[model samples]
Target chain A: MNEAAASLVADDGVPLKLKLRRAERAHKLKSVAMIAPLFLFLLLSFVLPIGTLMYRSVDNPELHRALPQTVAALAGWDTQALPDEPVFAALVRDLRKAQEESTLGLASRRLNYEISGFSSLLTKLVRKLPPEGAGVRDAVIAVDERWGQLTYWRAIARAGTPLTSFYLLKAVDHRVNEAGDIESVPANEAAYVTVFGRTFWIALIVTLWALALGFPVAYLLATLPSGPSNLLMILVLLPFWTSLLVRTAAWIVLLQSGGILNGAMIGLGLIAEPLQLVFNRFGVYVAMVHILLPFMILPLYSVMKGISPAYVRAAVSLGAHPFLAFWRVYVPQTIAGVAAGCLLVFILAIGYYITPALVGGPDDQMVSYFVAFFTNRTINWGMASALGTLLLIATLVLYAVYGKLASSDANKARR
Target chain B: MQPYATPIERVWFYAFRVICGLVLLYLVLPILVIVPLSFNSSSFLTYPLSGFSMRWYEEFFGSHEWMMALKNSLIVAPSATVLATCFGTLAAVGLTRGEFPGKALVMAILISPMVVPIVIVAVGLYFFFADIGLLNTYAGLILAHAALGVPFVIITVTATLQGYNTNLSRAAASLGAPPLTVFFKVVLPLILPGVVSGALFAFATSFDEVVVTLFLASPTQRTLPQQMFGGIRENISPTIACVATIMIVLSVLMLLTMEWLRRRNEKLRGAG
Candidate 1:
């Protein structure tokens, strides 16, 4: 060894710094290179957008800015009784200023888009602003007529903020009562808890449907000769080659009232009239199962393919019935595949929005529908974010439970 | 250990075979119907062939919107493929070969795109891109599509690398070759097939994605699937059949290419 190498090395000839530095550099480079694309992608698409979406929850500029005078006046008021004249005078001043600056229209439009009746309230209040600002609170109350009502006071008090918790509260089936205290919404108007329940139920139904249809086909493919089995496997995978849109659309076309399914049933004389299949729960289930069946079959079939025939043969030789042998020996081996397929289908089904939107009845809509509703219609980012956060939590919990089950199953197998 | 060939067993076996065949046929029927309908001379999208012609294909080529969407998809899919392939291959190697704390958590984060609802991802991206003034730009779409594509590439490539040997790289490193040099010259050629297949998967994924594209892009920048979505919403157009037909053809070609590469890769691995 060279003198420098010998000096750097231990008596056993370890080149400490060079080896460590080289290893360090390699490891760092590998990690950076490996993770860079994912980081860039998430940063641009996933992270940035999610950040913006979450930020939109507290975003209140048009309202707070236009009504700054009114908001500032009402900031520290006690909630024991209705507001006094000064708060009304602040509203009149803010409304007049807002009208002059053309900011009132934008603020009211934004609010109306969120909750529906705010436009007329703002418009009427602005138009009837007294020549000398007299009866400011009563005049403000006179515009909507609801302003004098206790409910109106409650709404104003609830929404009386530069930043409102209204959307977030509504997302979880709770809201600020007239007293400005948070409470559960009435059972009739409570939407989210039921929506979440429906989401879980629909996903469960779809998972079971796919498994029911897929297991037999998967077993047949597993038992077939290699040549035919491979071809069949490709056939099973064929639907995946088409766009998901096309598959969903095809189902719509086939299931509609005047569509092929109705035509077929009528021709067969099985029904006197066409069934109302499309735009209903039955259509949603059918479409989801068709789309997700291949996912179930492919994994289950692959797992089943790896099982040795000898195990079943040995079981039969030991005097087990064929049915028992198939169940005890063959079926146990497919647990991994079944787990994977169920997990895959269930997760995909839970996130489904399009098929359900197109085919499901109004009540059949999942939690994602409301998430979109808040975003597109209400423009209520806080509610949308809260809903999304809830969904994320549910998904993570499901995954954790799945992981625990899978690991315990693995442990049981080892035992 | 064959079962007794009783009449009931034989009958049940035949019934099972017939049912399975019918299911397979059912699965492929809609896809198979698209090509024939694409050739329908009649403008209506129905079977029984009013006539046979290439008019739909001609129309697809003639229309500016269809062609523009096609152009957008062509541009976006390749860029996404390149991005996904690089990152996915790197991740596959690191995940399989490298040791680190929180490795499982990192891997989960990397694959979470696949698990999360597309609507959530899309709306989140919509708000995000709007915030950054990138809502309609090619850079935004490419990055969004690439993020969606990465999970598939990572999944396929990692599966491919599962059985690969680590000793060869260690041996090359022990002979005084730099790690980078060894990687490019030795490791790359060995894993090139996995890398290529991953790219194919990435390409297919981005090309087929619709939800995120819809929310993140405008009419002028809409992808083909988004275009088809608009067409379906706006009116009943036979051109949708032509579009679906073309997508099917391209996907079949791509699937064939991947399968061929897989076979060739196996042969090459065997020879090596």
Candidate 2:
């Protein structure tokens, strides 16, 4: 040991540890070189884009950019009352400039998200600007009654900053009020909170339905011999591999009012009239459950396959009822799979867009539907980013929980 | 499992099997219904078929729009599959074989595209691509699709690498074989099944994807699912059923190939 320690020093008098590290550095660099191309690709394609979208949730630069002079003039005036004549004059100047630059719609549409009437109000004021010598405040107030209200000025002042929480607040159906406090919007104007609630409620119901239906099949697959189980496993996997759009299309064919289910029931004399099935909540739930059932089953079957049947037999030999024995001895062992599957199904369902959009009615749309609506239909990128951020957060949380559950299961098995 | 079973146990067993059978039927019924309906003479997607006909399939083949979308999908899916397989296989090898700091964080970031909601991804890519003038272009759509497909490739390839023996590569290196030759001759042959399956998954993902394409693609660049989405939204006809039936057959084939590859992988490992 003494000779080895003495020989550890190199001929040049460097220590062995540092020499080893210098040698190991090449291997480390090679590994990093292998991973760097993909890392850079994903960073450019995936991570940066999501970062840009999240930034849009707080981005309120258009209003500030278009109304620079108005924002500057309003800075000194307390928002306690209506803005003075100079502020109104500055607004007139910005409006005329914005109109000439073909940016009036963009500026006003941004403010319109804050207050309901600002869109038309700004457009109307732009269209009906008084003759060259006229007073700006009266001209604006005369164009629209909303310009006389303090609430409109407050929303504008709040949105004057480069970054604002207006869209995020509105995403949860809340808004900044005249008194500069956060509060809920009027009951009728409130839409997002209800949609979010419906998204979660539908997701929960679908998760439950998948669990209910998947449990029996998973149990059957676990208990059966290898041959039949493998065949049945293919049935589950085939649906899992099938195109999502195809499955949704199938549901539409079979569940529409004049479709197969109704026709079959009428043929069998179960009902005289065709039932309203598709284009409603029922259709959404039915299709979502069908699409997500495989997600529920695969985890559950793997877990159940690991559980020994001797435990149930031991319970039954102890004079417990058979159902009680199975439930008490076997079911608890599958809870990890249940948690993983339910969380996965719920996460996927809440963000579902294609199924509900095809099969659902007006009232059946979820939060993701609104996200798409604002993105494509209305071009309200702020609201879309805000809603998308919220959904992303919820999904990430649930996914973290699933990760823990899955890892712990793996750890337990290894032990 | 059937040790001294009571009548209640027997009933429960049969009932459970029946429920499982029904559930399986539910899983398969949707894909099955589209096949016959696509051939129906009537345009409606309902029962009581007028007669068997191939008009819808003809229409699908004849239409410029559908053919264009099909062409676009074929182009995008294969390109995305190849890109994803290359990047994902390299990263999986690096991760499994190399010791590194922050390895877990790297894996998490690589797989996160699969976890994040597609709508979020679509919206993000729309805004980002629009800023860079990549929107409405095939390059943008293919990049986005490739990003989405990478996670599947990484997952499968990493799983395959778990059973791989590292000493074989070391032995080859000691014998004066170059690194590339060792990889092609020893490691690649062993992991080829995993790579192929992963590529299959990437292809299927790109083929079935609609949301990102909707955000990124122009009307001229629409893929099959985007076309189907528009068709389903604007009109309901047996033409969509025809397209859907074709997709079902494709999925079945893909599933069988995956199963076959998995069995081959297991056999190779057992023999080795």
- State candidate 2's TM-score: 0.95
lDDT of 1 by residue, A1-415 (tens): 5676546965566677677777788886777677766667666767667666655565556667788877677677676667778878887787788888888765676556345686787687777775435576676666667666555444554454656666666667887766667899889878888888899899999999788779889999998888888778788877876687777667666677766667778888989898999778898898888888898998898788888999998998999977789899999889888998898888878888877877788988888787888778877666777777677667766666666666586587579
For model 2, how does the per-residue alpha-carbon lDDT over A136-161 read when each residue is reduced to its tens digit? 78878888888898888887888888
Candidate 1 chain A lDDT trough over 10 residues, lowest sum: A151-160
Cα lDDT tens digits for candidate 1, B1-272: 13766676688778888888877876887677666767889876654569888888889899998899999999998998888788777777778776666776777777778877887888888888787788888888898888888878787777777656778888999998897888888888877777887788788878888878877777788789888877765544568878887888887887777768878887877886
Residue pairs clashing in model 1 are none
| Chain A TM-score values for every predicted structure, listed in order | 0.82, 0.91
Model 2 chain A worst lDDT run, 10 consecutive residues:
A130-139
By TM-score, how accurate is candidate 1? Answer: 0.88
Model 2, B1-272: lDDT tens digits are 36767787788788887888999999999888889999999988887889999999999999999999999999999999999999999989888877789887788889888878898999999999999999998888989999999999999999999999999999999999998999999999889988999999999999999999988899899999999998888777899999998999999999999989988988888898
